[model samples]
Target chain A: MTRDAIILAAIAGAGLLTVLLFAAGADGAPRAIAALLFLLIGPGLACVRLLRLDDPLTELALAVAVSLALETIVATALLATGSWSAGAALAALVAITLAAVAAGFARARGAGSPRA
Target chain B: MAAGVPGPARESAGQAVSSSPGPAALAMAWPVGRAPSWLLTLAPLLAALALWLAAIPAIDPDQMTDLGLIAVLPPAFYLALGLLILGFCALLGRERAGDWEPGAYIAAWIVILHGTPAIVYGSLRYAWAWKHVGIVDYIQRTGGIDPAIGYLPIYHNWPGFFGAAALLTEAAGLADALPLATWSPPFFELLFAAALLLVLRAVTGDRRLAWLGVWFFTLTNWVGQDYFSPQAITYALYLAAIGLCLWAFPARMPLAASPVGRVVIRGALLRRLAADFDRRAEWAGAASSALPDLSTVQRRGLLAMTLALLASIAVSHQLTPIVTILALFALVLLGQCRAWGLPLVMLLFTAGWMATGASSFAAEGIREVLSTLGRANENIDSNLIDASLFTPGFRIVSNAARALTAGVGLLATLGWLRRFHDGYLDLPLTLLWLAPVALLGMSSYGGEILFRVYFFALPAMAFFLAALFAPRSWRRGAASLIVVALASVVLAAGFLVAYYGHERSNYFRPGEIAAADYLARNAPAGSLIVEGSPNYPSRYHRYEQFVYVPLVAWPRGNVEASANAYSLADIEQMMADRHYAAAYLIITESQKVEMSVPGLASLEAIQGEIEASGDFAVLFRNDAATIYGLAGRQGAEP
Candidate 1:
């Protein structure tokens, strides 16, 4: 599959998983697994693009680290601003993921190639 | 260099590539063909997974008795463990791991390797885990932290981890952070594997050593700090931070400029002041890692981003920031880092946070940290001895944990000895490994400082451990294979000791959580809710709803009023005391097992006493748990 197509598919999968996750509402193993993928997918892809590292495992690891730090920053901002809510936090995460993934792809395109 | 598999391994001087023929050529000449296929290496992992699947049905949380995760698992668990160990040896035994594919395969095995008990376990086991859920729930409900002066002050002060969980739980529309806790071990282990590999490569620039170090780390990591906790996230960030720093901005200074001109760095002052920097060593053999890997702008951006990560860590956990500060400074001092400004920035952020956001919690530690400057043993003992909960094989587990740690220490020492043997000189890495131990002089972190020290030091130690194999000396393929497997088995044994060490206390029941939730929901605000012991899932949710009074506070020091109310006869007098008013007492299944097995108390006698007494009435009762409301003096007189 094309790289763009894969990214789109991942986003779509995340969307589907997000809907299924909410629909399921409580706990089930599959949705839980889906939740893991959905939360990590965008950030993971973004990390791969932004890190510009050769190793996929190393890229993924940095992505988790960056995503966590970003999430913490967002959460801290929300708490500090008195705007902290579940909705606000989720929006911040999605926004950060989208921006990061977009910047990563842009960097890749500007460099005229993609490693991940 | 030690010849590992892949492309013709990097050779030293005009020497033939291997002590035998070559790793690949040796393998071909020995029993195996060119090399063992990936499928053969994967077989043991796949088989181990199957055994784990078979053992799941045998898990009975009801009869959890003194034993924990081991009880429900079958002998197949042992077979699976054997398979994992065998698979590791088989993978390394082939004398290859030069490519990323093999590393990926190993990571896959790691996921399976750690996933067994993590997935099969019934519910969240650790007592602190339930409280973590509650912390997230609290944050979700109210975005601000509730200042906790005593118990959970650190998490509350830096609510980054809990805040993220709250967001994820919200985004996923999950009830709580239960799934996160359940699946955390394997997921974190996999991510950690990636990060550790990056560090190993950065330090040695050898893929083989990196891969071997990662596998060794997994086998030996008996420290269970990676479970759904802030340390898990911070540990990942810590490694990522180190990678970004070392990869992007490695300094130009090589320790040995004059091969014949010896420079012995002995005391602390000399090490600190010994920065003469041999300018004539331009002809030194070691290639400069000083050149920026990325463009200047990109490198600067990465450094800026790393500082932000440090800021987040500073805000999240209390201890990790200290470790980060020490590491960054070590880098700067050793000339492994160009940016001296970064450590100062980290220091300001850490000290700045401690003064402002973390002030409420810091007041309690100022004197203790001052007085306990060199009392590492006392600090270590306080944590281990005070928090020890006895179950069946506690001694065996404790000894195994000690042996595992000692074995690691020995291997790291061997790395130094090997440095003398191989004529390798890099004192900075050794200094970095020892840096976290300095944290011992800091507060004991309520006895857990030692474990945290170990956690932070693992990456550095892994690098040194990689040295045990003649990885750089390509000819010593056989020795490399033997050394790597022996290291793996040692760590695997440690993994057993660490994971199984606190099974009884770590495993919690659904009913225990149910009773705690009931108290959270039903108990009037600020009312006293007494537990038979502090083992139940209480105070994690709606912590302020009731004053949590345990009948017996074991393993944690405060036994005053709790010790006085251990029996039914004492229950009457205990209720009449001014401190006792409209209090509910809970007795749980795990509590009963704990009481009887340890001979702490007779559950039957306590139950019988409750039945005979008129001063108490059952408020809520289940087969697994019971809640009673003390009537105080009203029932006592009548």
Candidate 2:
């Protein structure tokens, strides 16, 4: 696979891991382990992707997007566990979905494309 | 490649020779990308946690909670609302065929940069929850049960509102009501962050720059420390409105025939229709050349955003009509007449709606604008003195050669000038529109509330700073460094003032908490505990039933009766009549002066006479306070 595909896969995998950890419950040993894992793994893969890219701006945007996604995922997982109410849960979902879709579409347009 | 020794140069010039790669390029190729995305995201959060943990030894959780309660909500909610509004505005801009990114960028930058710190500070200081403890106690006393049980409507008391809301939610069977206290601030912060990001991305078109802006703003000391204030919420509302306005622009204007054409082609329906079409084409051509037509969707979006902006402002915990007006004016400038005129009109109407909808402090709100203007004038004068390049010879000589340092002296003056310029312009514009209302608040003349109302300019100040100093390139790093250094010094000064200033001793300390515990444990039930004066010391023992009676009130048997009677003689008579089980006399330095006064001296003499008569026994004695009990009093006495 191309390096770009590899990076995307890694980001997706990290996102999935975060989702699972959040789903598993955010307390005690399990949540702590998940948080540590994400904290370590997520930024690691993101940096790799950034270094492989030629454009600094794109790299930064990708890094920020990943970070935002990670936060969203953790927050969502916490909400899903009934930690937050239905209204809040819905709001979070909507916000995350919108952001993710926008990011994904932008990414698909090719890295380092000058903004219109 | 000089002509004198040009053999190699000539050969290379004839045959194009490529130079070897440079060291910088080679260094850039190194495999230095080990850190993953999630790690980068978590880094700041971890750093914050570490800092908090490090400070844990010195910082008390209770004290932190007190700060958190006041600083968190306003900024967070405002940012969140701003984001939603921005999205709608973006949609509007698309329809109107206007570039709405600049407005969005400004809105997002303000919300994220300012909103983050507000959340952090609010989380730290949670004691604001206790501000309404008296109201709760009053309710309990009157109702003869837990006040939370009754669903009685409370007025504009924040704590009461939270308590009542929590109780109601709990009644509806929500688990873990306690967590809501912690969750509320962070939840709002997250919402604000999201909104800020969204709006920024829309406006800048470059998401990376938007993120940078967000990070830069959040890292500022003011944002980190003052999140719990109502200004944060006002900011969020303002941003949301801006976003909505961006969304309102129509992608394309509706095509319509001219009135002259319709009148001329009155007969033959087909001919009339043809004429109408031709006229419409002419009009479209003219409009397209003059201004970009907006789509219906964009117009509706802007309308929606405008409404949202108004709603957010109206519902803000702190009344911020001044901020709302400033933002509205900004929108007008942004709209640039013609096509934007309609939106401006709509915004004005919405603002009117918000003004009418504001529930509390409506009459006193105007003072904020006046005070803002006053402070602005004061600041301008101060800046002029500080900014003057030349000083009188005597004054300069007296200060020594240390009067100016090359690096900071010039830059500081420049920074001061920049700040002054922004403040002067913003302050006047804000006051001009808001002065009438501010006058009303001034007339009411409540101290802190008036100040709080006036401080609505804080968010605007933050936005101005961001606009002025946010670096777009490496060269601007110097400016950023200066700002950071100056802000740090200011923050350090604030800490010093808070820690060691004259009012420091007035704050409730751990020692006071211990004293309160002792009083609660040992004092007899239903026994009247009287303090010597109604001062900060008496307030420190507020948890206890300590009724502070002045020395002159000692002659009166009934403290409450004397206060109601409002006469010194009546107070003395009542004090003489009442039977107190115990009296706690707290004599601070301030009270010693009162003792020198003739009337107060006589009261003290009366206390001395009573003591000599063996009517009371000294229970506790300290330099700060002395507690005396009736000689015949027993532990079980009511």
Candidate 3:
């Protein structure tokens, strides 16, 4: 598979697993591992990889920062709107992640080449 | 060969002349061209880890001296750190040490430095961290912020970090945020190192200098702000955003021609100080030209990323966004950053947040905030922290911290001059270093503005500190190696003393945790929790359910004279207040250490007074803490 496909697959797989785990009310190590990895970097990485910033460390750092930004914004919005739900927040993040991946793939397909 | 040539030159000359080499020559020559193998270099790292693991169990927190953890930490711990430093330097000295080797070493250094406290304590160290945990717990429980909450209203006003933490905590299926808080120091330190690398690489094209800058940053950062707090996350974001600005937006305009640049250049002292401005201008232009031209799409992506970082920072921290604005403005004014509109955008976000989301805090604290404006000298003086009030050991720790700060500053000055003489004038770095100093004139930040300034300045200062020992060649000489190693060791020692030296008051024993847990579980809503000092681990769970009354708050200056002059009757009367459903007074070891300063009754003395008074009953007693309640009050004892 292409690098892009592999990245999208990982993000999608993790996001789905996170949603499922939360849905199942799973706790402890399994839930912790899946949720932390996805929440920490999944959504942000999905978006940042499309930027095609090849420097690994910079990419990783920005991914974490962006993930945190998205999480904070989503959570804060839910909070300020007085409709706070961890499940809802997680669902929003997963939706954002999948949407970002799809958008990146479509953009790449439209350009007829991967981003440099 | 010249007679006066250095030994390194002579060795190279001799090798060049010899056509046929002996075993010794082959042995010596073989490794010269090859970097050390991964196994050989990683061995020290493994050994260091082993030593640290071995040393962990031997430590007893009870035996900790005023020197803090350094007083009780086994020599193996120090040796482990030394080995890590030596291993890094050895790899760094090699001609072909690639990114992976140095990077791994720095990561290990951070683990050894920041992770040690977490491992040893096996609990969260700082009271502020616990308070942050409480905020997260509150958010997780309530699912919304209460901006007008009586306790910790400031945190409610700016709840980005807590909100994100709450999401992670609930999502991760954790019981509470205690574990997250426990390991946050190293997590944030690692992030800071990554962000610092981005910023350093943006300015200097030298890869080795950039890496060394990161290493120096790890060693010299003794400010201890890399805990579980909003400042830690926002500081990292600030660095990343500035890095993005520097890399993506090098100014096209000449520095001397900009309005602020003109004023800076026209100053007689600055003119005299930087007589090499002509050369600096030429070098800066060359550097800016050397930066790769980014495509429009990439620039847009980077700008979006910068905006995201800035927006998060604006909401997450009150102080970092302001300092970030100052930095961006300085960068623009000095013609180092071409993104003139970015600072204005950051200001708008910050001001917008202050006007809307944080209006409650702004409204309440605006007068106090305005009072500190332009009182730069008083703000700086607020950080003096009278060591005379505490134990002599803290005096030593405080002095060591001051000395290290001064030492880094002095070395940075020398390095800047040396780099300037070598035809590299780091104007952007100089401005970055000076930008946070403007904060000194803004607010004292409750006597901590100075340390925060030091924290922000240390990145650029680390760059210059590394430049002081920056290798003249790809392969460093033995003399330079020894100097760098020794300097690192000295800085690391100072770091241990300065960063971990206050563990006597910061660490909470298991018994203390148990007492706190008991209170959280048993104390009903609206219960009054009277604490000896606000230094212990309280309010981590069900924090808002009770009214907390601490005898002495920080600054200890605003405390009424009656509080200090409390008799047994006064203590009884305070805890036995009729209005509250129940009242409990608890004191812990950490509070005793904090309250041992002059003019305050020691917690032990207060405990004795309470026990002597027959009206109060002992509800809970542990080796590390004690809780007391009114003897005959209904529902007082669980």
Best model per lDDT: 3
CAPRI-wise, candidate 1 is acceptable
| lDDT values for all models | 0.62, 0.34, 0.78
Q: Scoring each candidate complex against the real one, what DockQ results?
A: 0.45, 0.04, 0.69
lDDT of 1 by residue, B364-450 (tens): 675542332221221123226522444545545566667777778788778766643454444446656888999888664455566
| Candidate 3 lDDT (Cα, 0 to 1) | 0.78
Which should have the higher DockQ, number 1 or number 2? 1
lDDT of 2 by residue, B321-381 (tens): 4445544553343221113543455455435433542212233344432332221111111
Q: List fnat per candidate, in order.
A: 0.53, 0.00, 0.66
Best by TM-score: 3
Worst 10 residues of 2 chain B by lDDT: B6-15
Off by over 4 Å in 1: A1-5, A8-35, A105-116, B1-36, B61-68, B93-113, B148-151, B254-292, B363-383, B386-392, B444-448, B469-476, B556-582, B592-612, B631-638
Q: Which candidate, 1 or 2, has the higher TM-score?
A: 1
Candidate 3 DockQ score?
Answer: 0.69
| Top DockQ hit | 3
lDDT of 3 by residue, B237-318 (tens): 8998998898888774565666586776777777665455645644634543325567777788889888988888877877
